[model samples]
Target: MGKVSSAIINTENVYGDLEVAAKASGVPVKDVDVDILAVHTKYMIGEGEIQSVEDLSIFDNDEFFLNPELHIEQSYRVRYYDKTVTEKTHLPKIAIASNKTLTKIRAKILADSEVRYTADLADELENAINRTLLKYGFLIGVRSNNLKNEVRRVASLIRVNGALIEDVIFDVAQGIEPLEPIDDAMIYHYKNKVENADDPNSSVLSVVSENETIIEYVKSKPGRNGRNLKGELIAVTEAKNENAVEIKTTEKIRKEEDDKSIRYIAISQGYVSDEGGVYDIKEKLEVNSVNLKTTGSIEAGLDSDVTINVTESDVLKDAIGPGMSIETSTLNVQGSVAEGASIKARSVTIGGLTHAKSAIESVDADIATHLGTLTCSGEAKIDRLEGGSVRARVVNVNVAVGGSITGEEVYINELNSNCTITAAKLVVINQLRGRDNRIIIDIMQTPEYAKNLKVYTDEKQTLGRELHKLKANLQDKLSLINSNTSSVGYVKKRIEELSATGTEAPASLLNKLKDYQSLVYEYNTIAKHYRTQKERYDEVIAILQKMQDMIFDSKVVNKGRWVELNDIKFELIEPRKSICYVTKENELARVITIRHLEIAGEHIYEIKKSNEMPQELL
Candidate 1:
């Protein structure tokens, strides 16, 4: 018969469903025959076949059909075969091999033979074997007959000769000749003999010579003008053995021998000695300039200039010895500065507290003190001041209570009662309370008036000097005129005598008369000019006197602000006015209403007698 044409059906049912299988195979069910044998073996043995849709119910919906071959070789059968055989045979064979397997074999061989294999050498061997097999064929067949014999020979050689096979294989694969093996014992013996001969190139011999030279050089004396092995100069000096050598240097010496000896001022953490005098200190005693923590007090000798710093709870107890003040160059102290000491320095800073009776004088003073006196020429800052006097160019106080403060500019954050503050230009107080607080701000002299005063004073002095010179000139002129008057009188008397005789006057008398007349006219003219100058001098004197009086009248007029006040009544002394003395008999003083007391807000009050006080007063 001719070839039998059939559709291979892939289905999941045990009984072949021909219609579903035909649909899955894209064929008409009636035109194709059903084959149950393909379905029973899961399409592995043969293609499947199904008869009708009812047959699909017996199969799971998840079951899928794989694409089936139109023609499968049902007559062929696979047989057991070894992959190592490459010769042609009745069965096809597959070779199982990889780089990992070859690497493991190489490692085992190297371990057994006491031989080492680098990664490069191992990789080369693996590549040669794998390349040789892959190039021929992984499956043995008739064309790979010679290759099969070569692989079997290499495997047999490696199994029998072990790692020695690597050398032979490497030489064959890489086209290199085999190297001869070395005798380790004989090599070691020769190496030892060569080292004992003291060759210059040998590291061991060089090290030995170097050690001996070092030992000999250390034992030898350090001679001057000597050359080392490298021909370098070597200097030597004779001296006794000591722990350390001290070389005296004068590079940074600050004082000369003729100058006063230096002294060390130490403020330790204990009670201080009261020995009053300068103490010689061989070395400069250095202290930290920052916040220094201490526990006790500090006492210094008389006339000592020192810089002291302290922190924590400590006080400067002793008096800054009598007849000795801190120098203007040194002397600095910080922390709790106690009383009974007068400190004078360039600058003084108290970080903690400043007690009473501590008279601190400096160019600049900064104190976080409660109550203390500070007299600084530059600037002063205090934290809380009470019942003390502060005089400085600029004063800044956080809180002031019952103190007298005087400065060019005074700034107070809080002002309590009974504090007398005077500033030349400004007095700024944020919160003002309590009664009897006197805040006086002196209005500075106006620039215009100041300039005028300077000009007027200069003019007055100049005019005074001119007046003195003019007075002297006037006196001299008067004396000369007086002498000429006597000459004129004598000439007139002679003229009169000649006229009474009824005779003609002589030429000598006429000449004398003419000369005397000329002198008189000149004297009168000078006297008239003198009177003009005298009038001018008198006018100038009057003007200068007026200017002097104006300058004297230019006084500092005080202005102030009582921002907030308590119920206590206080007196405000008006500027340029005398203090009003209130008494029972002084009715005029009571009647006089001074407009200086200006209440800022709307407050109602009544002026009552000193004896008649209201029970409820606002």
Candidate 2:
């Protein structure tokens, strides 16, 4: 990257067409372009002055043309002579040269309604000239830089009225062609570009259909006045028929009761207007025109722009304003709607469920479920509900359902009863719905402790097996001590008598006495019981741990799509003496015998079955 700067003064050199003037002046000019000759009497002078007699001496040596009225006219005559004739000579008569200069005609113009004149005046003149030139089948004019780039020559000084005057004069170039007017019936495939409507490069104008069928149908209809394609009103065939006119125009419409006349005019290129407003149909009238009487009552629209007249025969269903709602049993929605809540006695109706590609908002009954945005001012209850189910993103209620709940998000304030609930995540306020007509409160969990409990159960089982083997070994040790105790007791009695007699015992005698005294308690009470107690405790801990882990795992079951009581981890609240009325899944299908019960984890118990065995009752 290098910084480069040069003082490059680009002066616009005048390459004017001056050679023709020099040739006409008979000056035998060389490379004399863009030069102008000053007219002096009958002679054309170059661009300088010759003042006195001494100044005239140069002309004597050059053999210049001498004019008799040179002083009278204050001009000189130019002549051609050979060098041999070096004296002052009389100038000859010569044809007067025609003066040629660039024609600089300019006009100030405002580019409002007068924009056409400002831009196309020169073009129009050029067209006319070229049309005249077409007779000769030839074209003339310089293809200058001015007209090459579709340049718009703007006026430098604008008038107080927003008018500007142009400075440059442009001539149409040779070989320029005249453009043909576009055919009204020309087929133009629309490419949908607004900027290219007047493009010089475009051969034909384009048109596009936004609502093609609607436009065509409107066109096939009629306008307010009975005008034909040639815009002439003809006599009507059906005189008795009040004119049922189809309006299509941009112009303001006029309706008069005097002549029963209604006018439809097209003012803008696109829009057409009747007595009501502008329309866009380029067609004639279908219905005849008639006077419409004003209804007595007028009501403003929601926006207050459109005023609708209410007649005596008209019916009013509902009217909604700001902070105003007309409560009705039947709520019909034809389009997409976002609402805070809905409470419909009959049903919430929808015309199109396309927007709900995956879901719809509806409820058949208080219990029967579909997708519904349910809201309750008071307590909401459903006794026997059935259907697919509804899962609202938001569920605010003091409510109860005899149905299952499922959706992406589920939240409830206080749910007193429910059949089934399956959700990804659930948050409840106050109390959650529970099974068997029971209320459950404050269900919270911690992940780490649950994991540790799992590990503890596994380790406890291993410890239990080791304790059982250790207990057996202790039993064998106790039996051996019992068998050796009597022999050892005889040895201990002799040593005790000798020591009491004040005699020193032998080394062999002392060793034998010490060994016998070690087993003197008859392999009995304390040692054996201690080992057995430790084994029992280990076994109890292992069983309890295993049970706890199974309960914890089942309490939060998340698998296999549908979960049943048998599928979850189960513990018996009340133990039965003999298992009867057991199902195929090894679950008790009946209470069998009644007892006070308490269970740790979630469980299901069946009370009665449709079929009963005669032998089971006995």
Leading candidate by lDDT: 1
State each model's CA lDDT, in order: 0.41, 0.30
For each candidate, what TM-score against the reference?
Answer: 0.32, 0.21
What stretches of model 2 exceed 4 Å from their correct place? 1-449, 500-503, 517-618
Give candidate 1 misplaced runs (Cα > 4 Å).
Answer: 1-251, 254-307, 312-332, 441-618
407-434 per-residue lDDT for model 2 (tens digits)? 2223343444433443222322233333
C-alpha lDDT of candidate 1 relative to the true structure: 0.41
Clashing residue pairs in candidate 1, if any?
A: 16-50, 17-50, 17-51, 18-50, 18-51
The whole-model C-alpha lDDT of candidate 2 against the native structure comes to 0.30
RMSD list, candidates in order: 44.8, 31.6
